[model samples]
Each structure stands twice: as structure tokens, then as C-alpha cells.
Target: MTFHTHHHEQVAEELYDIFESSFDEIFVTDAHGTVIMVNSACEQYYGLSKSDFVGKHVRELEEQGIFYPSASLQVIESKQALEIVQKTDKSRYLHVRARPIFYKNGKLKSVISYSRDLTDLMELSHQVDKMEQQIEFYKRELVQTQSDITGIIVHSDKMKKVFQFIERVSVVDTTILILGETGVGKSRIARLMHDRSSRKTKPYYEVNCAALPETLIEAELFGYEGGAFTGGLKQGKKGLIEKANCGTLFLDEVGELSLSAQSKLLHVLQEKKVRPIGGTKEIKLDIRIVAATNQPLEEMVKKGTFRRDLYYRLNVIPLYIPPLRERREEIIPLVHHFLTVFNERYNRNVEFSPKVFEAFLKGEWPGNIREIENMVERLVVTSERIVTIRDVPFLQQETYTSAHLSLHQKLEELECRLIQEAYEEFGSSYKVAEELGISQSSAIRKIQKYTRGIE
Candidate 1:
């Protein structure tokens, strides 16, 4: 071989070695944007061999979605250097920069596109975003917890876990379903989540679905345009959803919504837009939804009363508040909280007697926090400085003798009364057992069984 020809062939070999050994993906396309060569890294990135890409037109590969917005094609068209981000069909992100090579005559020779895999970086960015959201949520929660008026009382471990979960999810703009009995403070939980969320400054409206009449529920939720109905306002009326834009909408007693209303609500949730009962144009919304229900929604779904799709949408995050009888540790703290609240509200310094506290500890608060608040207010308003056990209306009515009971019934009543008194006197199951001469497990079992029936 001639000396100059051998020297040029050696240079080409070195260049080819460098191109094939690169960790990044490298594609060399002709002036017409046809793939002439691709590095082996393409196989790792797109799960396709180099042969699959080579000899294919850039436009054809882009149409096939191998990697969208082919950088080589853009460089070919513009005849200049281009940098762009592309997503492959395998869902991998690629950061690409393509530069067109030119001949001495200023004619395009080839395009060399270099791509670095950014899928891991993109995933890490998403994780960082989630962590930042959690940090923001905790900052709000810290302020809320340190404030004097913390609205709700939490003493039981069960409640503590629930609050922790709320703190984590409050920042996420997902639907939350608060599940509990009538007065276990489901609405309070919902409000707490909204207060800790990003939309706290915006309007937070609570709509009691059960309180709204079935006939007007639709119109109330999705407002009516002018002349849409016989009794409609002359100007178009904004619904609760529209009013709660960029905020939160708490749907209390959500299970009471009719099936038709449920379907419309589902559509709004899915589409993020709502059309009024008589409106032709749809109103867009940016709102978070928190729903509460005492009813068993899953059972309602099985019965075909509740829409299954709607139930799934609302139940994305379910927070269940246990009954007062189950978490009796909260009872005394709640009573103290209510006492302080009512005393300040009524301008009365009424104190509960030891026996009154005992009665409260032993009683089953089927009506939950609402009942406690009412009872404290009643005592603060009506009682003397010291509210005695006899002052409690429920306890006063429970004064009964076992004279009309059978032997089994009498023993059962005596067992229940003794357990209640012991539990009231000694708070913990172990302490109650120490006082009542029973096993600790038995004390716990008896407390669970009898506390609900004590009053």
C-alpha cells in the first residue's frame, strides 16, 4: 500500500474504535438524515440492537417512536447544531445533542447525534420532588401542632398513627375518604388535612350531602346558567365546586349523594371540569376533594346503590377514625379539652368531680366527640362550681336494681358494673387487674366487653 493511503486507513480505524467504544449512544446520519451507524449503547438504552436502527431513515424511526423528535433530523433540516431531550419507546429519557458536519463547499456531509441516558436522573428528580412536598407538609403540621387551639384531641396510639398518616398525605392532591361513625370527628380530620395542605389559604367549603335535598343536590353542587331552570337566578350561579377552585371541597356524608349526582361527580373528578345543570360550556376546576361517610361504601357498591367507579375514585386514601369506646384513652383528655373550651366560652369556671370523671371514663360515647362537647357545655351552663356524677343526665337514668333480673342476668350485671367501676378507678388494664384481682388479659377483655354497656 502507498504510505499516505496506509496512514489515512490507520486514522479511520482509530476513529471507528472511538465511536464503537463510547458509553453514550452515538448515531451518524447522512445529509439526508438516514441512520448510517449507531453505537452499541443504543441496545442498552432502547433494548434494540444497532442493526435495528442503522440504515433506517430518521423520520421513519421517529414515526415508529424509537426516540421522539430525532435530533439528527432537526440538525439536518436546520443545518446547524441542536440539543434536545427525547423519550424512547421504552420510556427512557435521553439528553441528545446533534451537530451537522459540513464539507469545504458548505454542503452538509453528515450529522453526529450524541445521547446520554437521563432516565435515572429523571427518576431521582421525581423522588426529590416528593421529599420536598413531604417537608413542606411537615412544616405546616409543626406550626399547627404548636398552636394553642389544635381543634382536635389525640391521645390514643391509634389516633397518633392516623394523624401521622394525615401529615404524610395532606400535601398530595389526591382524594381522601374519611370513614367513621356519625360523630367520631371525620369532618375534623378532613379539615385538619386541608389546613396542612398547599391550598390552605384558598376557600375551604364543607358540603353536607345528606343535608341537601335530593332534588336540588345537582343544582347546588354544579351551578345553573341563567334561565337554565324555572327558578334559576337571572345571572349564572357558581356552584360549590367552582367557588372552591384552587382550594378544597369537603364532602361530608358523601354516601348520601344520589346515583345520578355520583356519576356527574365522577365525571368532574376524572375530567377536572364541571358543566352546570343547564350550562352548555364546562367550567374548569383546580380543587382537592376530601369526602367523609358513616355509611359502608363498599357494601353500598355491592348493593348497586353507590357507583363502584365513584367509590374507587373517592377512596384513593381512606382514613378511618375509630369509635370513642375503642379508644377510651382519649376520653379524659377530650373531657379536659372540652372543659377548658366551654369554661372560656361560657365565662364559667365549673370543675368536674372525681366521680364525674369516673363516670365519663366508664361510659360508652356512642355519639363520640360531639356528645362530649355537648355534655361539657351542658354541665358548664347548668351545674354548680363542682359538677357531680349525679348531674350527668345519662348516669342519673342508669340507676337500676337487679331485683327483676334472673340469676344469670344478675351475675352478668354485677360483673359489668364491677368492671366499669374498677376500670374508671384504675385507667390501665394492668392497674385495673391489680385492683380487681383478675388477670391482666382478663381485665383487658372485660374492659372491652363491658365499657360499651356500662352506662
Candidate 2:
């Protein structure tokens, strides 16, 4: 053969090799959308042999499960390049793109497609959606937490004293016990301490001792290693103590911790170390423990339900929070605060009626500040226009009718009510000390002193 003919043949063969070995799935089709060419990945994706696909119509092969051909239709219809996604029953998701190929006279000739599978990307999208939902859920929780305390009006001197106590003790790491009637913002005060303290920037882990069963509580406070038991994460988990390292741990309803749990917790407080469940290694923590309860812990120790030694350890800094009733002066400000917050959340312009304020000042609020917050949220969620006395829930309307008495007698009565109520609410004098706003050990001594006075 002539050298010229041989040279031409060699160039053509190299071009063919490049087309065949390319990573892209390149197909040339006539105006009618026929498969003129394909590459290796295309062959694997559609389970097709070269000869079988060579002369086949692109759409027909897609129908016969040979290759995806929808991109060709898009290219034809739009007269432009566009991206499309495809899914197969047994395979993952895919992203397909199509572009029209034009002839020299500005007439349409055929379509070319470029594509990639997107199954993993779709999975990543799903994970992103779940994360967004979780963020929204936590945002709602934070709003509710803020609202719960906003309901307790705090104009009273006693509550101001509690606030002052919190301010004074915030910089110290002394274990603080919060004493108050149920719903009187003991947990909020605990948070205030953490927020104000040197540990404000660290994780603030909260535990509700009564919310979970004893078996789960240990694992929650100190994470367990995988195989610690059936269904435990394969790799052991970090305990809350570890999470609270260089942070603060808030123990709510601490009076409810079982004797076993209390002993373990006391060890943590004394030595600043925690040993996780099913794990031998002990983790050291730089944490501040804020224990709160509506209970009478000293009484519990007297009854032998709680340990006295643990109480003494936790009562290093005693801060008391008075009930909403004693702090009647705080009612208006708290109500306004909640009203403004809920108004924005519920999308309304709401204002309290004068009578509602009157009812608030007079009510006993056995459920304390929490009840007021819940009521405010309810009104915002369900009511329309400016809220009035009539719009307030049934229980709130009845608060003004419960009592009439002398000022000093009333103060004494409220104080006694708080003491008895706290004792019943928490069942231990130590808890009473904390929630009623005193040291656990002091709560013990106060109960002893008071009971003797009544006798």
C-alpha cells in the first residue's frame, strides 16, 4: 500500500480507539434518536454488548433495559442542553444531561448525552433534610424552654434575692442546690448559674432524674461501651460526664436519683471523676453540678430514702428560689415578657386584659411558673386578635376567687404552704433545701426547726 493510504488508516484507527476507550457514555443518534455509539461504562450500566446496542433505537433499548435514553427526548424537545434524573428499580439514582447537536445550516441533526449515577448524592440529600428537621426541633425546644420561665412574674423581693443569690454564686464551682415549689423555675435558675459562670461556653448537660428508669439512667449519665449489653452501640459511647468535661451538668429532680445512683454521683462530686457503665476507665470532669428539686431532702434522709453524706457534699452553695405566689410583684413583668414572645411566635398582636393581670396576681399557681408559661403558649397558639379575660383558659379564670386574708397571716400562710407543698413535691429535706432556696443540709435543719415550732 502507498504510504499516504497507510498514514490515513493509522490516524482513523487511533480516533476509533479514543472514542471506544473514553469514560463518558457518548452516543450519536439521528433525528429519530437511534444509538450510534457507546463507551465502556455505558455498556456496564445497561448490561449491553456492543453489537446488540449498535443499531438499536435509543428509546427502544431504554424500554428493553439496555440504556437510559430520556436525555435524547429532552434534547429534542428543548432544542437546548438540560439536566435530568433517572431511577431504576434495582439500581441507584442517576443524573443525565442532554444537548442537541446542530448541522451546519442551523438545522437540528441529533442529540448527545452525558450522565452520572446520583444514588449516593440522593442519600446525602436525605441526611441533610433529616438534619434540618432536627435543627428545627431543637430550636422549638429552646423557645419552649425560654417561654416556660417567662410565665412566672418576678416582681417580688424574695425572687430578686434569689436572682441576687444566683449572680453571687455564678462564678463559683460549689455544687448548688436549688429549692422551690414545683414549676417555680429551679431549673431556670440552675441554667442562669451556668450561663453566668466561667463554664458558660462549655456543654451544659441536663438530666431529669425522674424522667427515665434506673437502668437507662446510668447509661445516659455515663455512656456505655458497645456490647455493654444487647443493642449497645458497637463502639462504646461517651458518657454525659465526658460530654460535660470543661462544662456544667444540671441534675434536675436529683432528689429522685436512687440510692445507687446517688452514691455514684456523690463519688463524681467528691473526686470529680466518673466511671461509665460496663467500662473500667474513669473519666475526669471539670464540671459544675447544679442539683434541683421540689423535695425535702433532709426529711428523706430522716426517712432513710436519701444519703446524708451526699447531701452535705452537694450543698456547698445554697440558692433558694421562692414560689410565684410570694413574688406577686413579678407577675406583670413576666406576663408581658411571655405575651410579647408568644405574640411573635403565634403571629398575633395580643395584649393581656386588666382582669387577667388581676387574676395572675391573685392565683396560687400550684403548678408554679411552668403552668403560667404553658397557659401563655396555649393562648398564643389558639387565640385570635387581642386576648382578653374570656380568652384565658378555664383554670386561669378561677384563680382570683381562692382566698382573702391579712398580709402577715397571708405571708405566713404562703410560706407554710410552700414548706408543706415542697416537702410533698420532693419528699426529701435536701430537695426542699435546694428548691425552697437553701442548702440541702440547711433544708434538713430548717425542717427540723420548723416542725418543732409548730409542735
Candidate 3:
């Protein structure tokens, strides 16, 4: 009996020593929820000495506001282990786990509580949340920038091909010529090319050849020295070409340039140098040229109205954008896009009726994408929440005519118009089929039907 008592005492001393050396705040409480023991770590973390808590009821410490809602008291009441978050008077956060010790008879004997400091972990969590919010904000800003910078919307195969070609040619430094009718987004394509090119970070200069008079076109393109021409700036302003150094210069409506202007532009292209009018020295240029024209340059070259050398120089890379009627698939998507834009601008939520959509799809959009966008904006501002067919006055006559015609006849008319326009643009059944989103045989049959009487 004496030897057994000595061994038990030795084991108890070892356990106490282990408890004293622990890093976490540890407290042992008796069955009545009175704190019987506390480790030295409790004093360092809770700002209290062991004597401050020893032999005190758990409820007493909580009432004194040393710490709130004692974990050891919770374990005594629930008679089970629990983990909880607690706050100390010193404004520190602690994660505490309390385990209830039970006798063999299932009666609670005592409770041992362990607490770890949680201030660093909570601060780290807040930092991560802030970073995630910042990332989301940047993402939204990037999307808005892309939308504002490049409003080009491509959904049809025809426009998709144009974008693919732009992507391929953007990396290379060469002159590009865009051919299309007015308002077919030719200038937009020019801007897109510049945005995608290596000189994207530099200035993008645009000159509308047709917008300026013949007399001013030369001075606008090639800077004139002070006193070179009447009413010119005394300081001799830099021209578009010089302003666009190390960047891109877009010449819109290039076919409108006079013979003298054309010759000067050609010289610039050949020598990569421009001489200011009445200036003795030539300014060397490091610029890329992108020209757009609605006129047929080839026919003009044959007519001797446009210079052949300049034509070849500008036509190095030819990109033609078909009219909206030819690529009908893009009409509805473009309509929705413009609708969204206008709705936001006017702070309205207007919606289109089913019949309105049908009229827009079937009507001849002569001005192409620009016309559709304008009409949508007009309707968004002028019409109510629901835009019906009656809102579009221009389509009323066409709709009445279609109402009288048989279904087959109406479809034939639409098909004939599509085939004729596609053939004119593509010049081949295979290409027409690809552009119109139809089979080659169908395109050929329609083309032959539509062109039978003409040729």
C-alpha cells in the first residue's frame, strides 16, 4: 500500500509539470464550476495571475468581466465538450475548447478548458476579403474599358472572318485599306486595328478626307511652315502625319483626295519623309497608315481619276465589310446591344415587342449598323416601356404589303433579295453561301432565279 501511494504521487507531479509548461491557456474546474487550477500561460495571455482565478467560481470571473461566457461553465451545464470564441477585457480574441471530465458512473467530475489566441488569424481573414473585393472591382473596370474603347460587336461568320483577319494582320506593320459603304463601321474597324496593333499605346490620328475642303486637305495632312499659306498659324503647326509619329494615321474617305494631295501622300508613303510646305527640311516619319474608302478604287484607277501607285500602296491589305442586309444574323444581336446601351443612357427599361423585332429583322437597313443604332435610340427615348410595330412608321408600308402576300411569296422575296445582295458582294455561290449562312446549292439556285432576267 505504501509503495502504490508513492508511485501515484510521482505521476501527479509529472502531470502538473506538463500542464505548467503548456503554451496554451489551460484551466481545470471542479464539478461545481469552481476553477481549482490554472497554468502560468493563463497569466501571460489573460493579464491575470493564477491566484486571481484559482478557487473562484467560473461564473464569478465572467461576472467580473475578465472574460465573458466562460467555456468551463458551458461545459459544466452541457456536460459535453464544446468549442467557442471568447473575448477578453484586453480586446483580444481567443478560441477556447472545454472538455468535461466524467467519472465511470457517467457523472461529471471536472472540466478542463484550452484557449488559443485568434487575433492574427482574424486579421488575416479580413485582409483576404479586402483583396478579393479589389480584384472584383478591377475586373468590372476592365470590362467597362473594353466596351467603351471598342464597340465592335461580331456574331456573324462574315464579321467573325473580318475580326480574324484583323487579328492576323495587327502584329505586322503595314498599310491596310477598308472598303465599305457609308456607316458600315469602316472607321470603327480602323480604330480596332490600331487598338490591337503594336502602336496601341500611342496616339491614333484620324483625318476625314471628304470632310475637309480640297484647299485645306493638303495643309491638314502635310504641315505648312509659318507664312507658307495665308491665315496659317505663325508657329507652323505639326500635321496629322507628324502628330501620328510612332503611331497610326487613319485617312477616311481617301478617294476624295485631290490629285495634288494624292501625289503628296504617295511621296510620303514611298520615302517615309514629309516636307512641310515652305519649309526647307524634310521630317522623317515612323508611322503606319490605314485608309478607308467607299468608292471603287480599281475603277477610279482605270478612269485615271485616282493614281495607280497610290492605289496599290493603300490596297496592300484589303478588307471589305458587307452591308447589314447581307449578314442578317447580326441584325438582332446588334439591335439588342444598342438597346442596352440606349436604355442605360436614358435610364429607361424599354423592351421591344415581338412584331417590332420582326419588322427590324425584315426591313432593309440601308444605313447598316449605324441606322439600326440610331433607330433604337430614337425609340428608347420616344416610345414607352413596350415598343410595338406601330412605333416604327417606316416599316408600316412594308408590313402591310407582306400581310397581303402569301407566306411562300414573302419568303421568296426575302430570299431573292438576300441572294442578289450576297452574290454582288461575294461574286460566287460558295462564298455567298458562307456569308448568308445557307447551303451552296441553295445559294446557286436563288442566284440563278434572281439574276435570270437581268443577264
lDDT tens digits, residue span 368-448, model 3: 877888889899999978775557887653532367889888887777766654553344667888998889888767765
Q: Write the per-residue lDDT of candidate 2 for residues 1-455, one digit (tens) a residue.
A: 69999999999999988877766566667767777777676666556667776777755554443332256765665677865444332354345667888999988898877666544543444455446547646644444455333433344678777777778889988888887788888776777688789987778878888999988788888788778988678888887778988989989988898898889988998888888878888887788888988899999989989999999988777677877777765554555556656777677886443335545656788887777777777877787654544565552322322467667766655566566445433435666777978887676665544432110
> Candidate 2 has what TM-score?
0.54
What is the total number of backbone clashes in candidate 3? 0
lDDT of 1 by residue, 29-94 (tens): 999978889888888898988888889987667545566546786687678796665667775657
Candidate 1's displacement at residue 73, Å, is 93
What clash count goes with each model?
0, 28, 0
Q: TM-scores for all candidates?
A: 0.56, 0.54, 0.56
RMSD of each: 28.5, 30.7, 27.0
**Pairs that collide, model 3:** none
| lDDT of prediction 3 | 0.78
In order, the Cα lDDT scores of the candidates are: 0.79, 0.68, 0.78
Alpha-carbon deviation at 240 in model 3, angstroms:
0.6
